[model samples]
Target chain A: MNGTFDPPATGKRVIPGTYVFDGDAARRGFAINEMCFSFNEDANRRAFAEDEEAYMERFHLSEEHKKAIRERDVIGMLNAGGNIYYLAKLAGILKLGVQDIGALQTGTTVDEFKAALLAHGAKLKELQTQGETA
Target chain B: MSTIAGGIFTSHVPGIGQAIAKGLKQDPYWKPFFDGWHTVHDWLKREKPDVLVCFYNDHGLNFFLDKLPTFAIGAADGYRHEDEGWGISGYKPYPGMPELSWHIIEQVVHDEFDPTMCQKMLVDHALAIPVEMAWPDEEESWPFKLVPIAINTVQYPLPSPKRCFEFGRSVGRALESWPGDEKIVVMGTGGLSHQLEGERAGHINIEYDTFCMDNLSRDPEALLQHSSLDIAELAGSQGVEILNWIAARGAMRGSVTELSRNYHIPISNTAAATMLLENHETVLA
Candidate 1:
């Protein structure tokens, strides 16, 4: 499913810091996603953990996909066509939660990412309180 | 005719399953989220729906990217939860109502809304966690049978919110025409807003969530104004799960009234919400 990365139609607007995971990305990342999808089974996860290189070989991953997996680069994987939902299975095997991945992609420490989330929550609470009193 | 009891909509974040497993519902961080379920529990007990039609998305548990369907309905006699590659424990299988499932499938198909019919399907947290939340005590077996209607939120080119809402209305019409004395509750389980990918991973939009909670019952049509891309931009990438809520809302025919709602933020980086809507009018078949 990999060849040239044909960009999505001209009308689609790009959101900064966001990857849409459209058909182009899907085609590009199919091997990586297919491999991650296999991680659903314990034995497969074990197999991958036991020998990451061999496991990627079994899935016929491209050199780029293997590099991204080796470095644990979430954005790199996304750029290589790895959908977040499927990539999450691989993240589980690596003992990283969504927040950890968020921190990795956003270039923030885990604590800072968490603090930002908490601040967002606090802002919502303040808004609600104002709505109630006003 | 089977009665549509109402619709229950909530966020089905996987972390909630972990919280329940760890018995952390009363923990300061989780208390507000768990407290919201009191009204839902009371309503479920009082209404005693014989079957629950769940509108949820599968997060790589049942279907893979090989051949993802736009809409799929489970006609299995029972649905099981398996290990989803994550550390979350599995739940006991929920009994299914295959006859009712087939009825909805046939009815919706006849109504020109094509959906993949699965006589055997596995449910993920998107379907399981909400049931566990609603019936926390029912460990061995849940009281109500299940009809799982899975929509594809994991892939691009997802069915539009309008399409899902209309499919739900078709299912509602099917349920209304069924010649049974059973009461049914439809559930939409998924997001208010949360993104778990890219640089915008921890994104949450309370304003959009509030707009959804306020209008889902009173005026769901207002939601269709935003296209799927608009939702992803405003609600976050994963937040498009609100399509499930829209469909659940559509299933409630006749006048709908909001009974109770609870919305909390930062429940595993999500603006979690639970809502109950009741259908006041009974339609004669």
Candidate 2:
């Protein structure tokens, strides 16, 4: 290190485009995340597939979790404190990839979600040029 | 003095690990990504560096919410791959270069990098996925000794891009000062713009990824200007892992000769990318 390295900044804005899975969020999502983490085992995945309710119960998921799991509600799960990484395991069980979760949250088809994501890059470039010229 | 011979930036998506494990290289979905790796495999063979200072973010394996070290370095004798709650198993143990690991850790701490030091850690997909992707051979141990540098990309208040870059420079300086004839390659495993959470989850910014990748080989300092939020704004939240890549770029303080670059979309809802760079002075000199 040439000069002293500063530690990561604390309490910054959670940028407009993200749902940060921070400490509070992690606490809220622990049960749900743990439930999803169980899917690492084939038997656990099979158990979840066999009886979603029972599987969730075994993990001691909250009522909100059950509702989120039952409804296949991405945003609901997130709001109920679902870390996307852990939610991904549940998404895997639901045959929903992260893109599907994104689409569900953003109210777009998966194709549209991808298109929108790609579009932002072009928009950012335009903004950059405008800033440069100005 | 030990030499930092090169730097590699790559995505460590677990799906890629599954695809490679299932021999899905010829599968249309995977062919492009695998095609991008041929040059990487060849470079690894040609360079045959002694060790890899691998920077990766742990998934849910070793450290979870209870205690997330903003940055952790493994000084373990060897690393065992964790199950990662996905039933994926069976990997040859990854040997560690504890001697070199301690040397760099001491230097980094002295340089005020403030990394959590680990005597032992079970590496999850974040580290294992990339290693398996690079060297698929199950029977043989990986050729290069590893110094696992785990970053906290999972939780909030993750290290800033500039901080990560400075840590890399510390490691680079440490490598240079050590009185050892070791050839080291700093490998960063993560992100090229894909957000896996929030309403902006499926975010993949090709222009952002492309622009960042382009600068990585030339003006990495330009990347330091962008904050984590700025990256999240352009890339996705998880795409913030690009800080690992920026750090690897920082390790290459000398001129870099770009060997190969590959970018592919929709690798499990992420735009996967990889790049290989050789130290122009180190290799040529």
Candidate 3:
């Protein structure tokens, strides 16, 4: 509020490759997120694993949500209004670590995502070292 | 009156909990992050504050989008940690200081900050991981009582940094007003920077994170300049958890001295940090 900052160009500032998960998205993804929220329980996770389709039906998930889950498409899930935190439960059921989900979203291998993180960290270190020496 | 010893701001990534469960503190990937806790542990051992008022965001454990409060305070006798669907093993229920919780809640609400009062609440990794990291070796139970204050960072229309800072100041005033003689330590958990949602999933902003570590204790208002949306843009969506750190920093009402600080990057797609600040000449607001 203090600074003279420009307002976002569009009604919503579109950060490339980023989703804001705002109210619109929340309303859009409520059912899916609610279903993912239920995954907090081990029994629900087990039930989902037991009969994925039947569980989806119980949540009243739309075909779009069902397809996103079926394909294990993290980005598709996001497109369908799935918050990353709730979707994390789904990822857990699928045995996907955050790095795995990152890979899936970015279309990279898990190893590649890990390597990119390391490289980014190393870059930061290099910059800091330069700052110290400079 | 209750005395605020100081504050500790830490990252509460669930992966840290996973690392601890697997005894991988010494593993190469986890060592840098875990190593940062030594100074915090030493400080805690020496200070031994009676209660820790923790400011953290719940990750779909206690409150879902069904009805989320902007801020909530726990008034329970004990808080439980259950499986978060991510296989992070549960810990024994944490002892809660309901007397302190209710006192703060009453005072804060009187001060015109209405937070949802929970008689029973389930704490998630955001609270648990920091406790585990701070006191890794304690097997039986945590030495200090906990007062969990959850702020909503998960949903849109999140509280602004200015709002959280003011709420913390109110809580600080509440703590100072309490009649008990207990020593208290305030804690804020989560974020230096990292995102996990989109193509920007592995986003890490070293410059912003360093700025935060350097400025939080001395000039927290500098942090309040960024609106929630600005923070989401600058710190990554999840990185907005820095609001926890801001709120914790605001709770100290006296001159602050940075005791020790550590920042490490790429801890499970996040830049993790831990900082300890000692509040000197603790004064009434």
Candidate 4:
């Protein structure tokens, strides 16, 4: 433990690990409790908890779906896909205004927001071509 | 039951972690905070705990908006560091206490506290700050034995304050049953009251925070009955995250002799409260 600051006997100075059940830690963590849903206000968590139906009405989402999102039950959320886009809408979040719902729900939405931007550009070009230009 | 140093409560707020890395002995507001913490430093040196169970919430670091763990424990030899996007790179590595970590995992749930056990993970800034500041002498080359506790505070529908308290009791049970000559201490950090993000970014409820300081000490069970929304409403969204401290308290039993309590506001849009807890006779030098 001398001479210009050396590591322990192992030379690696192996610190203890961070995971308790490391076997399937990341995968299990992802599948089990994957989403992070938050409100800008606790009033939101409360009002929603008090009367979810009322809360859902406040947002663009449906009642039953709000329950899954709030509960953090991902499997249920995916199964009840009517309002799969509800969370995105509530935040006024746009993964591009138009998305292929079929792909988004299945987790195969290959296109990123940039692709959506490109699609918007195509629309602009069409509008210019068909312009009743002033 | 063996002597428990009780639990430590701290804010996993990213900003504080960043501030400490710059050698927090400076900065007008922070200078005082460090001066205050230095007392704890002195105390810790005298009563060096064999193992420290740190409770912190990861914010987009370690576990992100993509994937989050409810409760994760480190069972490896050393943990890796993180950047956290704030120019504050995390510790190179943090040593973990696997035995105590595992015992808590097995026994806690049986005590009605289902902990999310972490294995092969990284230490987010939330758990790193107070550890570094409080015990800076821990050698990364051969660091002190540490066990990192990552709580699911950031993601909504988090564990309730009462649940955290019960979980603490489970932790206590686990520690009591451990076979060792090691002195153990638990610490909870984060929030007497404060919030960040969105229109409520600057919210502070000094009164509610003081109330938390009191109730969390005496009647945490009653406090847990209150919805997470209440803490979020009073303290701001981030304020409710402090329920983990109540968990820290629950583990300490009804007899916590408070060593010291300090509360501060406007610490980068946070209401910061820090405390050292143990039974009266045990805490006395």
In the range B1-285, model 3's lDDT, one tens digit per residue, is 778998999999888877888899999999988888888888989888999999999999999998899999999999999878876656878999998899999899898997999999999999998988888788888888999999999888889999999999999989888899889999999998989988878988887888888888888899988898888888888999999988888889888989988888889999888899998764568
Ten-residue stretch with the least lDDT total in model 3 chain A:
A1-10
Write one digit per residue (lDDT tens) for candidate 4, span B152-199: 765546676766766777777777788876777777766756533222
TM-score of 4: 0.64
Kindly report the docking quality category of candidate 1: medium
Best-matching candidate per TM-score: 1
**Candidate 2 wrongly placed segments (more than 4 Å):** A1-17, A37-61, A108-134, B136-139, B280-285
Q: Is candidate 2 or candidate 3 better by DockQ?
A: 3
Candidate achieving the largest lDDT: 1
- What lDDT does model 1 reach? 0.88
- Greater lDDT among 1 and 2 belongs to 1
For residue B274, model 3's alpha carbon misses the true position, in angstroms, by 0.8
Query: In candidate 3 chain B, where is summed lDDT lowest over 10 consecutive residues?
Result: B83-92
lDDT by residue (tens digit), candidate 1, A64-131:
89988888878878888999889999998999988888888888899999999999878878988888
Model 2 RMSD, rounded to 1 decimal: 6.9
lDDT of 3 at A88: 92
Ranking by lDDT: 1, 3, 2, 4
Looking at chain B only, the TM-scores across the models are 0.97, 0.96, 0.97, 0.88
